[model samples]
Target: MRIKYSIPIVFFVALVIIEKENNIISRVSDKLALKQTPQTPVQSSRSANTLPKRNVSVTSQGKLSSAFMLMKRRLEDYSDYQPAAAVTTRRKNILLLATTRTGSSFVGEFFNQQGDNMFYLFEPLWHVEKMLTLETGGTNATAAAKAYRDVLQKLFLCDFSLLESFIDPLPVDHVTASLFRRGSSSSLCGEAVCSPFVKGVFERYHCGNRRCGPLNLTMASETCLEKEHRAIKSVRVRQLEMLRPLAEDPRLDVKFIQLVRDPRAVLASRMVAFAAKYKNWKQWATDTDVPIDDDEVKKLKSNCNSIRMSAEMGLRRPEWLRGRYMLVRYEDVARFPMRKAAEMYKFTGIPFTPQVKAWILKSTQASKEAGGIYSTQKNSTEQVEKWRFKLPFKIAQVVQKVCGPTLKLFGYKFVTSEEMLTDKSISLIEDIL
Candidate 1:
């Protein structure tokens, strides 16, 4: 009887120990399930589906956590995140459009000096214009227009391969050549801030002779992708309508700054430059392949008409141009360099940092003292009205008659012959209008 009782007691003790072990395992499983549940309340049914289910075991939780951490690391390493407003979230593409001798080069230089991160191309379309000249007789206007747009699209995308077809060797001392000589290290890298691809390309191609040699197309194209802003200036696109397709393209984000100068000043400057080119009117006509009857006045009139038409397009401010287009007067920029520059920065979504301000002050000061063929370094205010004195009274009359309407449209006052002859400052002309 004692042996039988001892056997039953041992069996009962084993059963109790087994029950406690099972309870402990269930408690641990409950704790783990709570740990695996997301902390935030599910905001949507879709998000609920993404969350771990209620029955996720400890083994599955470990795997899920590992996968989540991997994804987090990948996201952190990814580039191309912009903290700025959504409008500026995309890469910036700027187009500066103007007629010849409109201070566009000066403006282009402003963008070029925006430190690194800006790939500024000065007159990239000049090659297109050269091609058009060669094919003038046989080229279809519509086809030529399409070709121009196509090349621009590729350039804006930073594909420099297309440039090889037209890239002629620039003079050693040329401004563009000098820029290329700096190599990808200085221009594209921007003081060691660049993408891995840009760095690799620079390291590979930035050697001795290759430095100033023709641009490394692969390096340039890659660097362009890494840059924050890409800007191109061109005087070739005369009509604003020509850019409508580019502006409307959903894939591209293009901003247009139409630079305008006083029509009278433009005519006076062109006439002087044109007169200097040839010995006499007949020679000028012959060399240009124009009829002898096509005098300077007629040429001036044609230029004025083209400019006026371009300006008129902007004046209309059609549905497409509401926010993408900006008009900048050359005189205003010359007179109020800092203020106008700040305004331009605002329009282009570029930050007006201290570096930019310093550049503006230095550039304008230099320009004031050293006027070049394309730009003046004289006093800004004086430059605005210089045309009044430089142009003869009779010549001024012809320009005023031809461009007066367009001038008035841009808020330039019509100067009288008497005022011009007496060299008197007309009060209306003193204002922008």
Candidate 2:
């Protein structure tokens, strides 16, 4: 005799919607439980254009912001890490960590375009909810470690095939084909079609699976693993503590490549990009209590703060983060992209072939190698000193006043309003903005 099982359709649908909204659904097996469930992508097309609106309520915003910051701090506990075994051989692993708007997108594109075997997905981890919840209730180091471990286990051990099944309704057939093609089990898939989830799954697998050795991803059957199946074992690989324990795992070979840029330039671009969600600099300076209508200012502050925090917190985590990380300044990259790319390539232990170097140079010419290193567009050198003119005096002064010490700590010298336009400070300001 067989037992009969039935799940209420509406309840099932609700469960699916919750999972999708929370970005927790992974593993093809989950589809077994979620079959016949109705679902939609949490982020609609319109939502993509909208930044998570900053709450106008300072009390609530501050609380939430504080929470996420605390979570971020908790995560930092595992930054100081060393591989388990001593090695005579030297190798490189790369990870690029940057706050949004710090030129990470370009750096990712540059790597994907030019680096051999490197893949890029624009904002692959653009999980708005998770990012917004960077602050959560958690305790001290031991407690945080336990919580992180749990989260890591959940993420790493989850099944992803089910999550992909939920996405079946999406108009991503073309993307799927582009990613998976008709292939034998041994080949690596292309980047265009694979979601970041898929990429992460594979990376986690390659990192932890004892069957695979260092610098060897040439296994045939390994490449054919389905998306969800991969996620089941790789989902939580992102947690710092979990990653810390596995730092010595020989099965994983990974590296970090961080990118950065001038905060001023980043602020300028954000004003146009996020104008809808935040207030302008002038408006923001006047009132920190209310949410601004300008996306520009919101994005600028967020990006600047995130970058600063990443540099302060994330980059400095070599202790718990293992030796698999490297920071690449956007200015250094923008000025000498090829050289920096070469440096990055070396850091990642990915050999910089002439072909790769040429490709990097060709793609980066407009963004970095052109005559004026400080220009707005890399090809135009005259735009460097334009930010002082672009930003109102009061606003610029405020930004300088607010961010000056931090900026100077990171090697930026604040210019007085009077010196901003003069010949003496023009070149310095130009190089920065």
Candidate 3:
């Protein structure tokens, strides 16, 4: 009787061990989901390469390093820490390098959908890593590089074990109960996820904490690899400032997708967006801390010009860089997404799966309506030419004067004839910007 009871007890003990191991492995897998899978040794290797590097100065480096160290130290104190993993290893680091107001959001979505195994961080470091000028309080290059790397680790790594140890312990459901759940109108996590403050914290956690890991690292890696055995892809939407260094990284299989749009249309849409959110452009600029003369429309036009210049500069850099780059017009994406998407997939070396097609259709419809790239509903495609109708003639003339040179370079031809405005008033930037 003693021998029989011992055998039953042994079987129960084995089951408990198996369950514990499974739980740990699942957590490990979640962390790995942050990185792209490693490619074959032969395919991953690269030759020596160089491109135009950002002229980040020594002074800038010192400041950037200090900023990052501060952020990192604070990161060490956070409770829910997770580290990024190799699964977040993107096969090719893709930069949706474009100006604002181009259909980049949709393009980013398309790229995200293509790599079922790929991890995406939408405009992850734009706020902290935006290109700084000496005029903008001077920049520290080293600190900037470190900060950018921190963002990369946060986005790619899932090993947050160290960060986890730093948290100030609270009840298990404290965050959910006291903060997320109470104020939320609905039980859905979307409300909590969408909160600007909450979203900022989680995004920092998902990107920085090496231990916290991806949404489904284990499932994504095991399932995606077992099924396709393809390289992991990562898409990061970034403005011109951040693209300069990324364009030159040899270890990264970088591909740049540039989205160009009519500046007039962009100005009109931005003004409308600002007005809806604030009382006027001056108030909007003030609230956001954008450096510009309160009443000068040229400040806005100058900003627009700078944006175009940045895009053009990034798109042109690949000519010298070893990686691949492609230029895309937002209008084409809005009008003929499926046709263009096929080309884009071919360029990225990812197959345009059926699911990708469906996502494209949904995204295109949403972009058409919002007069912006990131929208959930279908709006109007006519917004491509909206500048003509929305901007007062005088304001439009000022924009034309300021951005005219840049616009012409981008293929926009201004309409000089007032009488032929309706028929011949084709945007000089219709083709490129």
The candidate that achieves the highest lDDT relative to the unseen native structure = 1
- TM-score per prediction, in order, is 0.64, 0.49, 0.52
Candidate 1 vs candidate 2: the TM-score winner is 1
Task: Arrange candidates, best lDDT first.
Answer: 1, 3, 2
In model 2, the Cα lDDT at residue 182 comes to 18
lDDT of 1 by residue, 114-161 (tens): 766678776766666566667575444455556667777887887755
lDDT (tens digit, per residue) of candidate 3 on 30-128: 335312211111110011011132221122211222212222222223212212321223355555555555656556667556544444445544434
| Deviation in Å, model 2, residue 235 alpha carbon | 19
Q: lDDT at 53 for candidate 2?
A: 24
Pairs with steric clashes in candidate 1: 367-377, 368-377, 411-433, 413-433
What is the model-wide C-alpha lDDT for candidate 3?
0.44
Worst 10 residues of 1 by lDDT: 53-62
Off by over 4 Å in 3: 1-90, 126-245, 248-250, 276-298, 311-320, 363-376, 417-433
Per-residue lDDT tens digits for candidate 2, residues 1-433, read: 1223344666789998998865554334233322322212212222223223222111221122322232233323322343343332343323345554555544654444443233322221222223223545322334343443433222222222322222222214222222111121112334322223442223322322123221211222223232211111111122232345534546335554445555665565555556664344535545553243345444444345434443443433445444565445565566666766665655554555676566555555564555332222343233334454555445555455334423542444455555563443334321221
Error of 2 at 356 (Å): 3.0
Judging by TM-score against the true structure, name the best candidate.
1
